[model samples]
Target: MTGLRIIFMGTPEFACPTLRTLIERGENVVAVVTQPDRPKGRGQQTLPPPVKVLAEQHGITVLQPVKVRLPESIEQIRALEPDLIVVVAFGQILPKALLDIPKHGCINVHASLLPRYRGAAPLNWCIINGETETGVTTMMMDVGLDTGDMLLKSATPIDPDEDTQSLHDRMSQLGAELLAQTLDRLVAGELTPEKQDDALTCYAPMMKKEDGLIDWTRSAQDINNQVRGMTPWPGAFSFLDDKLLKVYKVQTASGAGNPGEVVAAGRDGIEVACGEGSLLIRELQLEGKKRMSAGDFLAGYKVPAGALLGKKDGAVGA
Candidate 1:
């Protein structure tokens, strides 16, 4: 419990809080295993993973293996003498060789309740699916993808207006807190593993840019969910007169018009009709233009009353 040689495996910013919590609690984090640095941003400069940066700050040893299943990678992890490996958004399916090296095996801190939204993009899909509540699950890892037995779970409600960015930040801290509880229970020998019901499984595949395309035929609430889910990346968009109109925020309204028709365009908001109901678009970005309020956009760009969306596949943002 006190001197457990732990190896922390994770990548993105979502993974940082758990690692930070482990260190803050004085857990024996001997090494950090994160994905390799790669080109990012418009400059395409190679940058380290958020986990690596955090680990280095605390002077913990860091490891970046292209493929965790490779011989060298396996050997490196094996030599760490890890009693347990705590993985969070590690971005790789660890092989059994590495998983078996640790005395207590690997434990994953996932972002969703097991058997539901289990896959690469659970955070994004949970919102897109309009789930009412979701939470963190710490599970004993196996060869399968998020198919491992669950050790602990903590649930929280999803806010109606919550975007992925805001929800992600909230859940990152939530996962950290839940993981601390899990580790303590594990150390106390009070943890019980629960098998997930396959009958309740739902896969949340990785998001695509095309997935953000707003289908006017869908209800306003559904489109609103899509907008929330894709926020800050692969953002929800509609074609505005052959141009990409990125929709950042929207509120459901009660007006009536043909789907995609502009109910009204003004300083307050751009009211657009949906299949079932209308939407008050509060914020958006035109192609090759900066994101702005609907009022500001309307002040400059031309969005007439009868203008249609989804007319064609508009150009992608520069």
Candidate 2:
């Protein structure tokens, strides 16, 4: 455990806590590898990944290889002579060459219980599927996509109103703590690596912007899940007079009308009909407008009762 040379690999805010925890705990994090800076936001300004920022702040050597699997990248990592490589949400897949370089091999702090959500965007898919519980897992890394041997796992209940942003923040912290514990047991040689059951595995494929398009034909609860899962990203969206209408928060309500039809729009909220039930829109953002509560949105813009929402050309309830 003493003089453990660790090389950390990660990107995004989800990975920040783990990197921070390792550094703060005085672990020998010799170097950090993160995704390259990319243009972001409306200004198209290039920004470094959160991990890079944290690593630089601690004066750790930072690497941003475009392809970690490449010979040069692998050689660069091999030169570090790290005892272990810690990964979290590092956008690229690590080849076996790099995986085998570390003495203790690589470990990942994944955001879901393995053999379940075993891909990118696990947290988002878990909420969209209406899972009652979810958790984090620290695993021994392999070449396969999250198909790795597990080290430790910690579970948490999924709140009724939990959105991706809130769940992400909570899981990030949890993953950091769980990873720390896993490393302790690993260093002590007290942990057994458990093989994941392939039969129970489900993939959380990377999300796309089109995935946020709301299909009102789905049930109220399903739509609500979509709203919650897609928030702070490609937000759950329908159409209002051909303009994109992003639904930030919604709750199930009682109403009946054609799917996607506005059932009520008043001071309380805007109630929209779905195939199975209704949705009480609590917060939303129209294209080119700021996000606002349903009441605030209704104040300036009127959605007449019985007007249809969703794609103008698509068949209703298709």
Best by lDDT: 2
Candidate 1 versus truth, CA RMSD in Å, comes to: 2.3
Least lDDT summed over 10 consecutive residues: which range in candidate 2? 309-318
Best by TM-score: 2
**lDDT tens string, model 1, 1-318?**
356899999999999999999999999999999999999999999999999999999999999999989999999988989999999999999898888999988999999999898899998999999999999999999999899999989899999999999999999999999989988888888999999998999999989998998888788898899999999878998888788789999999998888888889999889888888988999999889999999998888888898777747432222
Judged by whole-model lDDT over C-alpha atoms, candidate 1 comes out at 0.90
Model 2, span 69-160: residue lDDT tens: 89999999999899999999999999999999988999999999888999999999999999999999999999899998999999999999
Q: Which stretches of candidate 1 lie above 4 Å from their native place?
A: 313-318
Error of 1 at 62 (Å): 0.8
TM-score of 2: 0.98
* Model 1, position 286: C-alpha lDDT score: 88
Which parts of model 2 are misplaced by more than 4 Å? none
